[model samples]
Target chain A: MTTRRGTEERIPLLLGVLASLAIALVAIPLVGLLVRVPWSNLGSLLTSDVVLDALRLSLISSIAAAALSTVLGVPLAWLLARRRFRGRRVVRAAVTLPMVLPPVVGGAALLFALGRRGVVGEPLDAITGIVLPFSLAGVIVANTFVAMPFLVLTVEGALTNSDRGVEAAAASLGASPLRVFWKVTLPAIAPSLRAGMVLAWARALGEFGATVTFAGNLQGRTQTLPLAVFVSLENDRNAALAMSLVMVAVSFAVLLGLRDRWWNNR
Target chain B: MCTAQRIVRRTGAVGVVLGVLSALVGCGTDSDSDTLIVFAASSLVDAFAEIGAAFEEQNAGADVMITTGGSSALRAQIIDGAPAAVFASANASTMDAVVEAGDTAAQPEVFARNRLEVVAPAGNAGGVSGLSDLARSDLFVGLCAAGVPCGDLSRDVLGEAGVTPSVDTDEPDARALLSKIVDGELDVGLVYATDAASAVDDVVAFATGVDMTTPYLIAPLDGAADPELAAAFVDFVTGPVGRAVLSDKGFAAP
Candidate 1:
């Protein structure tokens, strides 16, 4: 036993070198970004009119997207978790497809399906004067399309692993299914639900390709932080760096704060 | 799952996603000295394609990989250490950035020039006729962001015409703006005449009578792996063969 522990403690030199390389591959760019950040002008850059407008739009759209995800995702999660249906695997795959699909492709899909001249958009616009693209609603839709899958998948996994006997007990004790859900099932998966919402929110806040493609980028209308960072990289690298740092900070805070508490389904 | 196991699993999942994505994009390739990389602006896509083919034909055992994107974006990439032998930019400003960053071997020479045109979707959904129609607030007018040469020219032409454009979206490049117009998502947009020519079936281009033009510049990068090959590529772009191809693609001699 002692000999086994000794050998286990000594990682091979080659492995150590390889691991360091792997970390360096990821850390070098981040370190470089930090080293080159326009620190003296960061505050002013972040508070500039362009940056401020993008920040405001990003927050409003991402928060609205998160709320929409929770409202819509929780139900979809429950449906997948509790219901037994044919082609369930296909449905599940379709719902979580965004998790793996390139955000740009997802954006293109959304554009083809919902753009002003899109299949449904044309008819809808003709009927009710509701144009989805280039509007705030379009931004929210783009965010929600890319963000909701995180929430749905997280909540669904939790629901699948949850103690179902308790929900059955509530239902059997004269409570209707809706009452049992609101009073029992929801409270039970609250931790995972919160985790999912935060993940989705962070994902939405950082959304770029999908938002720019589907919603289109306008200064005060559709430009989010990621879009701002992208466009700024051309003319104003410092502003891009500043906006990137903000996203990195926010995402880091969200992941670090959530890591210990809820990520393990704790 | 335990935290350690979850972390490892998440990492594995991310690795798989990245692997698939990278594979979809193309294989990770080592830099090959024989392969000359040329970064060109979006408006030069068609012209550069023919030029790349002709350059490859002239120089045996040489592979020319031409990548097209917004000149500003390509300039940013080059400045950020992209390993390209040559850069062909849509505007002098973007090429100036590369020169200012000490990426260029010499001053970029203007090889070609392009003018802006007002374009609408194939159906002309918003009934846009001329540059003046871009000011109609009811129509969804799209324009390239000022970061790109086309956008700068568009904005200047509009200002010169005394038209207050009611722009709905500012696409990052002429290509994006053109694509949105062709997709019928945007009613009208300003793009390079070359781009408008490339998609005649999907969009209708109108002469704006603005007389504004952006000059295209090409330069070999400093410290290129194959300096001779890079210089040759730049010369080929500025030479008679390049001019013939550029003219066929609707570019005027600078």
Candidate 2:
């Protein structure tokens, strides 16, 4: 990957201009949000009852989604990466479909599959009297449906590129299959695992369309921070801005936490 | 041609197309000739849609584009300069927001009236024989989120009926709530009489025993692209033809 001398100086003006415009596209709206933020009472607004409830729910659902995604996505990702099975490619495509689908569509798909009158939802309800929609459980389900793809994709890439020699050696040294996975393979992909978890958690925290569509927007029950901001945008602009500030700050912190893994040059 | 020249030509073509697209977006149905953009409350969807087509037929070469949402949200957009040629609000205060902001060409006139009605699936009824079902915790109840005209009105109707609902989802708009009701998602829900009537095939409406007296308002916007045409459209909505269409769709005369 050696570069010739003065190659950076050859950068074209068109690309430089477009690159700056791209940066502005991402940065301007954020700066506008900062400008309109109600600075005087932001601390108080952030600590208000509604805000606190939303934050608590967001943390609970997002963390739960991330954890569930890891437990489920890792195995799926591994099978996709390592197994030579029929329909493996189909499974991988299905797993990643959520990443590209509009989250509202994903939520509607969830409703069709898991709603009260849904395919599985009908039998599940008839048997257990449990309805997934319009519940806190629904919020977690929606988040996991949309966020799991990130974890699965990242972990699968890591697994595919990971060294298998160590696990084979550990197996030859009398380690059981489970011990090889835990001791040799798990630690090897730990970096990617951590990165994947954080990415999935951040996606879950910011999830809006699916959660709102599936869980419904009830303050203190199903209203995550994003939904709270949306409901408030009509009547309370200051509150929406305050909540958005919290989201932006948290997202920045998550990105900073992953800097060591992704921003190796820094 | 050189590869660099080809890239430049492609970029230029893209730039021109983007420029044209943005110009069209900037106009946003604000032109004086063909398009008439109307922002109406969600409950007025079926009624206004009919009125729009009739108006279009009379005013040949004029297209009517209607955007429907919660009245409060619609007013917020109008006040923020969405360039809507006409606005039809479900409540007076929602229309007042635009009037107070000086975005209306004139005072909004009361054109129709609607009230809340409870509804459940037409068949396979969910024990929703009366308003009492809205209070049942076992059944899923849906309503428009607070701050929208329908949400505010729904709360009023519920309060007058003295039934405290176990609301499951506060939909962003009344139409979204209505669609879900028709989908058999909700056991019972409160929606505009007009909405319930439009969806009579799917839902069975019940009287909440509360009279709904809210008056619907419509007006021409201040910066309408075609001021004369906008005023004409407003007149058409408040006129005899509009009245007939509104009543046919289950709206009461204001």
Candidate 3:
């Protein structure tokens, strides 16, 4: 009985040690970044045209990507959750494939699908004279390709777990299907919707491989913060670290603000 | 609740064991004294592979491990304390960066030089004949991004020619630019002469009279585990056998 009591007493302490180790794994690198930040030269570095241009491009492309992902992913998620049909499993697998595919491979796939000489893109370019590769639109497409999986998976999980009885009740009470969906289902999954959007936005913002591969890296054009960090790392380590810190701060702010708004409203 | 607590306790023990094992692996290297780790630029991938094989054949009981990437990326790895005995960078500036960082145990020596050439699709599908044609608004041109050694050389040559091309993309490296040109996605791009030589079937090269060139530099790093082996490898690179390999690979003598 005494030995059992001693083991019980030690368990919490052991768990505490493991938890701290996990925390340290994350914290040490962050601390290293903070320690090496060139505080004195930060003003100049942040003011440089390269940094400012990349910041603006990152914001524009990531926001555009998140919006596109939500527009396309939500309906797809609903289909995956509410409907059963032939090839459903394949469709579902395809949607989440980007999550596992290396971003470079994803970029290559995008090129094969939408490049100037691609099947659809060739005809489109011939008719419209619009090329997608090496353009800002290419950045958005690449970002959306890689980021949509996050939003889709999140909303699908939320929809699958929620009670569908409310939707049926609304439908039986003389409400149209669209109206019932908006009034009952949409509100029910608002928190997850918001969370998914934030996660997708963060992923898009940090996207590097696909963006560089598809859109190309041109300052004030397609170069996002992540790409800028890669380029800056070639010449200036301090500038690269500063750019990374900027991304970290922005992502943190967005996620924190989302949590606060959702929790406060609830 | 008691069962849940027991599960958590088991998970905690597992996590502790995993952490300790990883820490042990992180500090321990199995090949203690026989391995020579060389960090090289991506452009040197083919040349260094051949050189490493030759070096291993000549030196008994010593193996050469080569890691290749963009010069800057390799330098960053070295700065972050990657276990490398020698570093062969594509440009002097990259080697200079290491020297400034005090990473070099010996003075770096230039082994080879590379010059830029204009590359386009086979049969000159773009009808681009010279460097000035790059400035044509209708043609799509790709150049290496600023800060990349090849890009820096491109900018220098373009400036000397007094022409600014309509560059639709700034690729991160010469190989990427070459691919786009070969794919006909880019009408033209400035790439190393060696790159042009290797991809002759895919891309046709034009002499642009651009004199800008970059030098390849090699040095033994201060943190090398086997300094003598590193020095020997450096000698092999600068030796006659190394020169023959580089020449065959299209590099100019330094």
Top-scoring candidate (DockQ): 1
Candidate 1, residues B139-224, lDDT tens digits: the string is: 99999987778888989999999989999999988888889999999998888888898999999989998888899999999856
lDDT at residue B119 of model 1 (Cα atoms): 96
The number of the candidate with the highest lDDT is: 1
- The sequence of per-residue lDDT tens digits that candidate 3 reaches over residues B82-143 is 66789998898878988899999999999999888988888786898888988987888899
What number of backbone clashes does candidate 1 have, counting pairs of residues 3 or more apart or in separate chains? 0
Scored by CA lDDT, what does every candidate get?
0.85, 0.83, 0.83
The weakest ten consecutive residues by lDDT in model 1 chain A span A1-10
Give me the runs in candidate 1 sitting further than 4 Å from their true place: A1-25, B1-33
Residue lDDT tens for model 2, A190-227: 88898899999999999998888778888888999999
TM-score of each: 0.90, 0.91, 0.90
Interface RMSD for candidate 1 relative to the native interface: 0.9
lDDT of 1 at A5: 60
Q: Is candidate 1 or candidate 3 better by lDDT?
A: 1
Candidate 3's displacement at residue A247, Å, is: 0.5
| Least accurate 10 contiguous residues by lDDT in model 3 chain B | B1-10
